[model samples]
Target: MARNQLLNITIWTALLAPVVYIGVMIVRIQNGEWDLLGPEPGRAVTQFLGTWALNSLLLTLTLSPLKRSPLSINLISYRRRMGLFAFTYMLLHLLAYMTMMLGWQWQDLNDEVVKRPYMVVGVFALLLTIPLAITSTRNWQRRLGRRWKKLHYSVYLVAALSMVHILLQVRSSWTEFVVYSSVLSLLLIERLLNRQKTA
Candidate 1:
């Protein structure tokens, strides 16, 4: 197959895999294969979604640095699509938390934002991701140029806030905290190294 075809296949697989996994989980729960009403269901969902979001974000951040290596240009083509997928999953994660846990109550949002520092950070991160997602379009990229880059740099902030969000939520889970912190460190290091090389 051609390089473009291979790249297309990879991008499609990356985008669809999470949907398929989440769909299967939902189907299993509906079929009584797994109980969604368990004591830890909410925590389970939160951790799962949060972890997936972080992983996708890391993959998105890796694209440019990887491209600067001897890797093929086709690899870089996956960046935008992956970034959009990251945002899609992040939005789903936020919506699921709000609808399933908070019952879509605006008052509950107000309370959470004020009472919970982690929730506040998560909400802020979600807000930051909005413009990046909106401007992920080719047309917007062409129109905005340099400004688009400055806007998308907010992804780093989003990633930092997201880590803090997860860290605070998983209070006692030191293992998870370590794992996520390590990954975020590596991603940031890759970004720094790439910048130094370009400079």
Candidate 2:
């Protein structure tokens, strides 16, 4: 197969794998095969989606630095798609939390947010991701011109807020915190070094 075809296949597979896994998990849960989801299926699904969203966001951040490496494989072209997938995962995470944890009680948002300040940070990160995802198109790039770059820079903030959100979670382990923080720090440092070299 051609290299581009291979890349497309790889990208689609990576993107769809989570969706398929979660779909199957949901089916299993519906079928009373609770072992897959364990006890408290809602929390399990919410955490699963949240973790993938964070992973996807981190992957999106890695694209620029990867493109600078010898093993890039032209992956930069798919950064926008990766970012959109990150947002999709985040949306699902929020929906899962709302439906499973809160029982879809919209009015409970205030209490939940107050009870868990991390929810505020997570929701804010999601809000920031919305504009970036919406304006990710080539047409939007052309229309926004220089402003587009500035707007998309908010992704760094989103990434930081996401880390903070995770750190604030009482159930988040130190190991998880260290791993994510290390990855984000390394990615940010790579971008800074690259900027200095270009300057």
Candidate 2 local accuracy as lDDT?
0.91
What's the CA RMSD for each of the models? 2.5, 1.4
Best by TM-score: 2
lDDT: worst 10-residue window of model 1:
37-46
lDDT (10s digit) by residue, model 1, range 130-161: 89988998899999999988898889999988
Error of 2 at 132 (Å): 0.2
Per-candidate clashes, comma-separated:
0, 0
Candidate 1, TM-score vs. the true structure? 0.85
lDDT of 1: 0.79
Clashes of 1: 0
Global fold similarity of model 2 (TM-score): 0.95
